[model samples]
Target: MNVAGARENVGSLVVHQSGIQCFNCKEFEHFAKECRKPKRVKDSAYHKEKMLLCKQAEQGVPLQAEQYDWLADTDEDIDEHELEAHYSYMGKIQEVPTADTCTNSEPLE
Candidate 1:
């Protein structure tokens, strides 16, 4: 084996410094563990999976048999009041105002 050729071969090999990667934004430099960015809000698919899990559990399915718990894997800590406010806002946007909900008495002239 030629020693000079071996040195050239080793020099050609490029090495990259591996740092933390964020799963939320799929970016490097910052890790998902220490990520300060807003949590990726769960989409419809997430809710669908949760609903399926609930249905399965209600039917006496073995939840422990699963290798991973998708719901429990999240690192986000949801405040009870914040969750309630979110649901309350959603309710306000979704609820249709009926005659009972209307408190205005006099008609606009």
Candidate 2:
């Protein structure tokens, strides 16, 4: 092959290997990975804001509902004091059953 033809082939191979292409900016014959743009916090902030806006757009509607469902069966017979006493008595007590107290006994599966 001619020297100029060989050089062109080599250049093509280099470009393919480097994964370089330009769509937005033409000054650098490469993609965003090889971009020369100055790093800015605003760029990341813009992306975050864009994501939040997209999410809000997805969930556009607000929902409203009653705190308690009136149609559901309500238990009014159990008083608050009785329930509090039952729970408090349970908290103060630890029941070690007398039958299981033996250390030499084999554990029943």
Candidate 3:
């Protein structure tokens, strides 16, 4: 006749009526797995910057001028010029294949 004792006897697999809280929003009434809130997104740029800093620290050398500039500039100042410079600098660092390097193509007729 005791519902609480009967529920306890039934086992812990049964969801409790209270004390459940969502990890996402830290709210009550729902478990984290059942939370309706959207998952948090990771900041890829921040992580990449951190990784670069770690690499620099391991090498015991200061960051390149462009990287130093990038780190010093605020997010709001990332205009077209800054982006172009970043891309150009990256291009200089990485070697890209040109038409002359293509070995699979026939000569022009």
Candidate 4:
């Protein structure tokens, strides 16, 4: 082969080898064994992708909703404490811990 043709072939081989990605940092053109940069730590993006991926263990299992029709049962009576707790959690502020914590600065006449 001509010198120019041989050089071209060698150049192509280098280009092909450079396409390999580094296992350490995930960048192209170098292998992990030859990596000069610091080892990469998993970032939020990596965690996000991990969270988004469905695990094999949950795939075949059917999702159960035993309380899906909870509203259908109306015969159950809500106790006063339960009602009050639910109301408080739903954001109807009935009372404050102290007068100073209350938004009303004026004294009650």
lDDT for 25 in candidate 4 is 70
Stretch of 10 with least lDDT, candidate 2: 63-72
- Against the true structure, what is every candidate's RMSD? 14.5, 26.8, 18.7, 21.1
Question: Each candidate's TM vs. the true structure?
Answer: 0.30, 0.18, 0.25, 0.26
Whole-model alpha-carbon lDDT for candidate 2: 0.39
Any runs in candidate 4 off by more than 4 Å, and if so which? 1-16, 47-109
Give per-residue CA lDDT, model 1, range 1-109, as digits (tens): 2533322233778323144345445566444445688765654444445556666788878764221344355547876765565555444444445789768876533
Candidate order, TM-score descending: 1, 4, 3, 2
TM-score of 2: 0.18
User: Distance from true position, residue 15, model 4, in Å?
Assistant: 10
lDDT of 3 by residue, 1-109 (tens): 2565322233647545355544345576554456688743324444345446656867887754334543443555556765665555444444455779867666532
Best-performing candidate as measured by TM-score = 1
Q: After superposition, how far is residue 66 of candidate 3 from its true place, in Å?
A: 45
Name model 3 segments beyond 4 Å from true. 1-12, 41-109
- Local distance difference test values of all predictions, in order: 0.51, 0.39, 0.51, 0.43
lDDT of 4 by residue, 43-104 (tens): 44433322233232245433212111211222367577645554444453234448567777
lDDT of 2 by residue, 13-75 (tens): 632323333322433334433457643232333334334444455687332111012112234
Worst 10 residues of 3 by lDDT: 1-10
Clashing pairs in 3: none
